[model samples]
Target: MSLQPPVYYIKSEYIETDTGNKVSRRATIAGPQNIILGGKTIISSGAIIRGDLRRTGPGHAVVISLGRYCLIGENCVVRPPYKTYRGTFNYYPMKVGDHVHIGAGSIVEAATIGSHRELIGDIYQSKFTIIKDCAKIADNTVLMPNSVVPALAHFAGAPGQFVEDLPESTQEMVEAETKSFYNRFQPLES
Candidate 1:
């Protein structure tokens, strides 16, 4: 089947990406060529993805690969690693998995952010915020750019530092949350 988003959640119709993925019209996705959004993902209003600052390449090397069913909240900025090496400016790639929810105003500039992590903030401005699986970033915690956060941890700080590890061994909480939310809009058979 084609990688376009399913007709299920078309209720909130917004701007359709070139790949047929629905994104908020208010979202700012610069350089769509460098961004790869998996099917059924929701990018809310005011989100920004800087795909324009990529290095030259042969194939369509995606700078950001967001997996299916991922959610990017309002005002979030997802961009690749940017650095000026020897006066040469280039950006790295960023990969994200399913069921990952990034909240408002968060800036993600990491190489990868795993699944089941819910990062909530009012205005996340980071240069390199790397979040692992099953992690939760609390609200209003500004994360330093280029910081790596491990899995199953709960982080909080003015600049958002690692606070504590999650006691749960598995990702039951995340699984339940994603499944239930998705199942709600499923059309019932006649």
Candidate 2:
């Protein structure tokens, strides 16, 4: 059976960059200079990216770095994780690798989210969480602080835990899905 690509009829809500990054005008992006979007990433309406939360005592810091073909769904908040060290609190950088999809209404304060990871709707990823490559976080899941999700694992529940191992084809599947999603995201014809 052939699968159909999802279609979104977004009007003139998004601003497409030269590098193919589509960022919604309604999205609240703090400190655009401190955020690096690799390419072909989509930041939907109401998404908030807190790039102003930078590390202390740094000349120049990248608070949030997102790789190619990433999707930050509507109303999602992406913030860097912070911690205290030697009586000084500092925000750490958050890195999201290629083909990552963070669903709508999700709040992420993760240190690292590896390539080909999919986080379903309404999920909360706590500070210092590490989600490895090809991992999937189910809808409404909450990943506790400092949680580590192994590669190819499917995690779910309030305090997310490994539910099962994903198929070996997960990487390819995610890559194709993300690419297709990006391609199918279109501006509605007036």
Candidate 3:
């Protein structure tokens, strides 16, 4: 399969960083300093990244870390997972590996999402969920808390369950698709 058609956004609505990150002005990103985008990532319009929900400590902390060529689709909400430990509620960091895509309107509170994974549109990933590499969460799936998605699995349905194993070519396919998505996402011509 080939890349999708180009997605054009209004230039004034997005800020393209030197590292080729395209952040939409309409997106709500809390605590910018606490969030790290590795490069060539896209934060689409209406997406909300909660970097303010950080680990409770005395020192500086990174709340969210996203690797290269990732996409946070429109209206998605990404926040660090939190839990009570030692009688204290605390939020932990969220790490997303390279070439990952969180699809439109998805809500993610995952602790770690591995490389080349795709969380399809409208997915709800609960706290502390760990998604391994090359996994695909089907559209509208709802993952339970503390869920662990194995590598090369395809999960679907509410309280997501592994429905099938993905092909070995998933990694290459996902990488190419993510790269293509980034390349095609451009500002409208003046």
Say which prediction, candidate 1 or candidate 3, comes out ahead on TM-score.
3
Please give, for residues 1-190, the per-residue lDDT of candidate 3 as tens digits.
5547898898999999999999999999999988999999999999999988756677646469999999999999999999999998788899999999999999999999999999999999999999999999999899999999999999999979989999999999999999998999889965
For all predicted structures, in order, the TM-scores are 0.77, 0.95, 0.96
Worst 10 residues of 2 by lDDT: 3-12
lDDT agreement of model 2 with the native: 0.93
In candidate 2, stretches whose alpha carbon ends up further than 4 angstroms from where it belongs are: 3-6, 58-60
Shift in Å, residue 146, candidate 3: 0.9
Ranking by lDDT: 3, 2, 1
lDDT score of residue 84 within candidate 2: 95
lDDT of 2 by residue, 1-190 (tens): 6867667756677788999999999999999999999999999889999998767776757569999999999999999998999998889889999999999999999999999999999999999999999999999999999999999999999989889999999999999999999988877854
- Which residue pairs clash in candidate 1? 105-124, 127-145, 128-145, 128-146
Worst 10 residues of 1 by lDDT: 1-10
**Per-residue alpha-carbon lDDT of model 1 for 1-190, expressed as tens digits?**
3333323534444655565455877789898877788876777778898887757555645478898667787788887877777887666788888777787777777677888877776646465567788888888877677787889898887877778889675377776655555444332232
Q: Whole-model lDDT, candidate 3? A: 0.93
